[model samples]
Target: MTVALMWEARAVEGRGEELLAWAKARVLEREPERRETFRAPQDRVLVITWWDAEYDAKLPELPEPGDELVTRTVHRWRFEAA
Candidate 1:
């Protein structure tokens, strides 16, 4: 089975570009099967990675940025192909 992991965060104020760059640089370092990144209006950045493993398998995730870089806590989700 394959698992998809999604990670998202909102920059504190005017740091959306910084946060997005940081996420892009880190999200794929572990080298998953596939990955993509996105930006939302409210300084939100999202990264989704597809791994060729079971849902229960461990996977590397985008690490948290500096506390001052984000407004709220980062969010993550995992899903297995149905």
Candidate 2:
């Protein structure tokens, strides 16, 4: 089975471009080593990411360092493929 996850989140305050770049690097270099990944969308204030669908369940388990949005503007999606 293959899993795909679509994530959408915003950067807070000083965690803007720097944070986005970091996330992009992780998506481009690291995450795919574990599974699969789609290129990130570097536009607007939202940091969009895609990776293994199963990774969604591991979100809270990961180190969510950097800016954590305290607003309701964050949106994400998880999709699984057979």
Candidate 3:
């Protein structure tokens, strides 16, 4: 039974680009089979990442200390084929 890991995060003002870059790189290295990854900043945009058919995955690297790239929230959802 394979699963998908859904990662959604929002960064504080001004730090969006760096965080987004980190997310893109991390997914490539950590979960090469990711189905999707997106980052956009509007009034409060979201960075959405999808890891496809995952059995287990290492934790995504955390932002460095003093980065202040807080995670307003995080979510995980199970995927079921239709």
Number of clashes recorded per candidate: 0, 1, 0
lDDT of 1 by residue, 27-62 (tens): 344799889999999999999999999889978888
Candidate 3 has its poorest 10 consecutive residues by lDDT at 58-67
Arranged by lDDT with the best first, the candidates are 1, 3, 2
TM-score rank, highest first? 1, 3, 2
For model 2, how does the per-residue alpha-carbon lDDT over 1-82 read when each residue is reduced to its tens digit?
3445454544555555655565455533244314322333433233333445463455421224344632234455555665
lDDT per model vs. reference: 0.90, 0.43, 0.51
Write down the TM-score of every candidate. 0.93, 0.40, 0.54
Better of 1 and 2 by TM-score: 1
**Candidate 1, run of 10 with poorest lDDT:** 21-30
Query: Which segments of candidate 2 are over 4 A away from where they belong?
Result: 13-15, 27-63, 68-75
Candidate that scores best on lDDT: 1
Off by over 4 Å in 1: 27-29
Write candidate 3's Cα lDDT for 1-82 as tens digits.
3455555666677777766666655533464344566666531323334444445645343233233664565445555334
